[model samples]
Target: MSARGSVTAGRARSSSRDSILDSAGRLFGERGYSSVTVRDIASAAGVSAALVMKLYGSKEKLFAVAKPTEALLTDLDVPVSELGAALVFCVLMRRERGLREPWAMMPCTIQDTPRPEATRAKTRERYLAGTAGLMKDTTPDLRYASTVVALMTGFGEAVRTLGLFDGWDFDELVAHYAAIVQAQIDACQLAGQD
Candidate 1:
């Protein structure tokens, strides 16, 4: 084949792969990780199941391409300089939505698979490392930022398991969570020797 032909084929292949991954992401986000299949992704992307299998190798491989860890990173509402706060906020929001989030779901994804699990570990580590210093600043409130994120995540899961989401309003819940954080920060600043 000519160079032009090769280039065209490459472009088509990339587009198809992108579509497959995109579809997979949406489906995974909507349905839990275990429930989504390669065929589901392929059909959503308008491609053949064989193509999905060939491209990603298996259902797990498909997740490797479409998973939400980095996607959450991209959606964080923080600046590069204030990554800790951004990460904290991101974790809070995700936890508010419960573990159905990329964080919780990714763990579920790796729960059984023998595939490389390092990426999953690294992601969780990165968030903790990223938020370490900022979370430590809660003297008045003592660990307010850090505690909020941790509790927020745990609360979501606990509530979801208990089927409590139906009665909750996110805005009110976030406000309630924020109040806890503010009290911590205030306690810290007030304890200063000034």
Candidate 2:
């Protein structure tokens, strides 16, 4: 094959790979890992199952690549006093932009997958650890960090997954929810100082 032909083929391959990953991410996020199969992702991506296997080897490998571990709060520089609002605002903005919060899918995965223990471990390592890191300056208590994580996860699930507060004013929702989160943070900080 000519160099031009090789380049075209490479681009096609790259596009297919990207499509597969995109499909996998959406399906796993929506339905959880065990509920989705390679053929399902392949069909969604408009690629052959053989191609997916050739590229990612297995469902597990594809999941590892597709799972997102985005830091819960991208900008952690917010003052502790305002961290609640910042965190709530970030999540709401992402929802408005139609972004998926993979950590919010943990409950689905835990309930749906056969290997619940493994799923729980992954959640702790990837999701909880990352969120806790963002709160390191506010408190060193794992219990407090876990509470914050729970609140965010529940909030995301209710807002995004369940559409509990659809059509609500963004600012109003954020203010109400952020106040609850702020109370938790304040208590944690006070406990730490004692």
Best by TM-score: 2
Q: What's the CA error at residue 61 for candidate 1, in Å?
A: 1.1
User: CA lDDT of each candidate?
Assistant: 0.57, 0.76
lDDT of 2 by residue, 19-93 (tens): 998888766654456668999999999999999999999999998788422335543556778878867776775
Per-residue lDDT, model 2, residue 60, is 92
Which stretches in model 1 have alpha-carbon errors above 4 Å?
69-194
Shift in Å, residue 48, candidate 2: 46
Residue-level lDDT of model 1, residues 88-151, one tens digit each, is 3444444543435544444455565566477657655554443333434424433544454465
> Where does candidate 2 clash, by residue pair?
none
- Backbone steric clashes in candidate 1, count: 6
Clashes of each: 6, 0
**Would you estimate the TM-scores of all the predictions?**
0.39, 0.56
